[model samples]
Target: MWISWMIIAVMVGIECVEAGLNTLTKVAMTSGMSDFVFVVYSNSLALLFLLPSTLIYHRIFLLGLLSCTAQILLYTGIGFSSPTVASAMTGLIPAFTFVLALITRMEKLDLKVKSSQAKSIGTIVSIVGAYIVIFYQGPPIMFSQSLPILHSPSESPLSNWIIGGFLLATSSFVISVLYIVQTWIIKDYPAEMVVTLIARVFVAILSAIIALIVESDPKAWTLRPDMELVTIVYSAFLMVTIRSVIHAWACRTKGPVFVTTFRPLGMVFAVFMGVTFLKDTLHVGSVIGAIIIALGLYSVMWGKAKEVEIIENSFICRINSSSEEVPLLQNKSIDV
Candidate 1:
């Protein structure tokens, strides 16, 4: 139980870091720096820091490749979309993951199983909720009688912003796949070493390529002291590496489900930050949509717990039966 709590706490912390990073990135875009430049520098620096340890683990290349692709899609998406829209779309990740798992036969759908049915229903409901949030801009209801907060210049909708948000959501789905693959591969490697190496090397190469294509002035690569640099470094090192390590440790001690179930905690943190720091406004529709999303998340989690309990009970029964059989055999030998 203690371990479970630790996992939840770590997941929550990671979510907070993610939210804060999003906020920082939004601010950076509002400034003169292009998303391409931001990605190049931040990832390049991260790669530099991670190279030594990654090589030591001998998994720098593979992990780097996967991480690079994920980052490119994600950063590009952020460059194109508002952080609020991007973050909300991320709620679709679990749904995407479930579909992928089914396609890959990593999980199965059994209509007869209550847990399975619940998971399927919950996933569908969550998807519907996301669409409602995204497209259903109905008449605004009064939440707190507050005016809507204005977005920064960068955050203002370009013709491509909607496309970018969709792309970002897709990027997140792809990254989740990479995560699943990493889990399979990391069985033979250290998580820290693998993650660090990938962040450092692979992403650096990818970002450099993007910089060349996107930035008009090659001089954008020149380093200058600013809040963006600080934010990037903090995000790359502390948020990406350090917090990830902590979360991995907690997940190992507890379980993946426990960690994953706490994902919504970050949403709460993001909302608070959005309101206070970014000065985002809330409407009744958005509020109601959030509540629905939360309920859907809970339903999915409950289904997962029930499934785990069933598996554990079956294993316990098997062990007990095996033990009883061994004792009976010994007694028969003694009597003979």
Candidate 2:
């Protein structure tokens, strides 16, 4: 139907927009914009837009801390590595989320169930793929042939690449933790928009404090009249407002599974935009590792889908049995 098509279009558009902005941010940072300052500014702008939606806030400071930490790590990783690396690392979130859920007792692990076994195996495979990407650069499949100026200074060293990879991985893990916490918070505070606004406020304030401490140069807070300003405005309006609204709508209309199913597409967009616009090289190890991660991600998704299906089926059967028992009890009463 049209609704399904629209959802697909918007989800793909969201991924493309995210990839483009990531590339733009990298270019802006490469042009002397401080990563810390960028995070502070973008989040501050987001706060301005979300101010009108402020409804309530509970004891959710931890949400802000996690989000701020994740943003700092993510942006710093982009500065050290490339958008492609950041996108590739996102595939690890589900794997990390599953593991954390088990640790938190939010999810159970049953070795007898094939679904749980698949999730466990998928987690291991995802971790292995992450290691391979971090430890091995291999040869360039697509060398930088244009936009020579965009080549990241940090990318010249293997150690920086490894560090960037770990930072990105940690960022994804932090986001997974955020997801888990968000679920808990939603039980008490059902207003997602309010929770998001509160979290953004926290991120803005926290990031600003950190920026002031690390980037003491008053000039670092000053925005350039060029791409820096553009990136901030774009992030504030499109990334913060439009993207969030679309994702929330999609999740409510379809389901989280429908939204998450499109996540892998982000890496494709990142690779295309990075290679084409930023003239980033495609490394063999990154490709191989990404493919491996994708495989594991799909495996985990399948297991999750199966588990959900089984749970739904069991609930339906229970309801039907209860209904049948109700009729038999009524008949016995009538006979009496």
Candidate 3:
């Protein structure tokens, strides 16, 4: 019970961290930090924070490279496409992760099992709810007069929506792969700090290589002691390190399916954060969609809890049976 709740708490924390990351990344881009440059700086700063720690695992570097590749492709996809499409595509992460987990034998696909069915249905509901909130914002249902929220102006969709859609979908799939592979790796390594550091180091190296090839202006490399600096520093230590450690621990303790299921919750968190910081309007669609998301989250949690309970029961039964056999064997030896 405690472990389940801990995983839930971690998921909530992840959502909060992700929401802040999205907001900060947007502001950084607005401040002339290209996606490539921001990735380089953020990952470099993260690596700096991680280098002093004792390293235990090297295999995590490969996972780190995959993660970095996904981020590069994802951000670049957003650049090629519209933010609308990117946001919508992110809802696919959990679905893709679920599929990969099944293929990798990390997750059992038993449609007849109640837990499995619940998990499957919950995933679909969450995905639907996320898209509803993202793609269709209805009129304001409620508005606070104190702090007027300004919905950021929407830009026209890219002409090559098909190409952009493909890029974003591919990026989402890669990210899903990262989630599964990272979790699988953690089962053996089980060193969260080491994994975190390796991930950051590799991401920094990759992002730096990409940044050099693309960003020519030396001024773009310069970081003023402003929001840009704040974004880099805060995102590096708190955002990357803390979030990565928490995720690695969760993936180690739980599974990739559990870790990825929380992605939809990010949409919920982003909505509230937007209302608070961006002072965005509270639309009816937002209200309904959030409720649906909450339902899906609850369903998923219930299914996961049931799965844990079943495992624990089987384990307890095995222990009891083993103890019974031990006493019988002891009696037989005494008789002999």
Candidate 4:
């Protein structure tokens, strides 16, 4: 149990780092490069860093396919939408994962089961909160800026950006599927090496495709002595490779739900950093939505805890029954 708590702590820490890296990546991409170029370069660098590990593990194919597909969709969505919007949409990943797991019968749902009930209610609540965050524009707060810092003085209309936000949300859904599949694979495989290797290979292929499509200029390949490039490298090598390895290790030690529960912790950290460092204005509705999200996250965790208890008890009972049967069989043979 102590070890489990430690693993969860590590997962939360990793997620926090991920949020920071993601925030930095968005800033870097806004510099000059096309979104496609940023995606390609980021993935390529990650692949280069992870190649050796993948070769060592020999699970290059499976991991590569899954990671590449997910990353491609994720990057494409990011290219289309605001980072904040994208992050908010990604908050729905847990709900998507839960629904998928239920559909596949990987998870059982019963009204009589308190955990299941909690999870169901939590998922619905979190989704509702997300919609409120996205669609609601309450009375202008005192701090409400006339213009968003991220947007140019002459920016596109909000209605025009709806498609981009929707694309990002769809990307989040696809990512959740990949995460679920990866979790299932990790049950039988060494997750660290497998995930690292696959990410490297798949991202390599993905980057090459993006480069061919968007970066026709040879100058795009030239390395610039820019801080943004450094941030991208850090995101690729440390955030993608090192942190991911740690996350997989934690998941193996603690279970996927234990790791997943800490996801919202990232959002909390992101909000804090955004307000402090980026000077992003927060609205009353956004604050309320965030609180609701936290509540929903807690509910999901509660449900998952109950599910884990049920599974543990079932395993214990089976083990005890098997032990009893073995002793009885041995006693009968001795009498004979």
lDDT of each: 0.63, 0.75, 0.77, 0.66
| lDDT preference between candidates 1 and 3, better one | 3
Alpha-carbon RMSD of each model: 3.7, 3.7, 2.8, 3.4
Measured by TM-score, the strongest candidate is 3
Error of 3 at 168 (Å): 3.8
Worst 10 residues of 1 by lDDT: 141-150
> Each prediction's TM-score against the native?
0.83, 0.82, 0.90, 0.83
Q: In terms of lDDT, which candidate is stronger, 2 or 3?
A: 3
Model 2 Cα lDDT, one tens digit per residue, 1-336: 577678778887997898788788888888889999988888789877877876566556898899889888988998888777787687677566666667777678899999888867766666566556545779989887758557654445888888888999899889777767766666555666777777777888898899989997888888889989999888877776677656556545543433544555567677677677777777787677768766765676577668878988999999999999999999999999
- Please give the lDDT score for candidate 4: 0.66
Say which prediction, candidate 1 or candidate 2, comes out ahead on TM-score: 1
Candidate order, TM-score descending: 3, 4, 1, 2
- Could you give the candidate ranking by lDDT, starting with the highest? 3, 2, 4, 1
Candidate 2 has its poorest 10 consecutive residues by lDDT at 253-262
lDDT by residue for model 4 (164-230), tens? 6677667667766666666666666765776666666666776678668767887776666674688
Candidate 4 TM-score versus the reference: 0.83
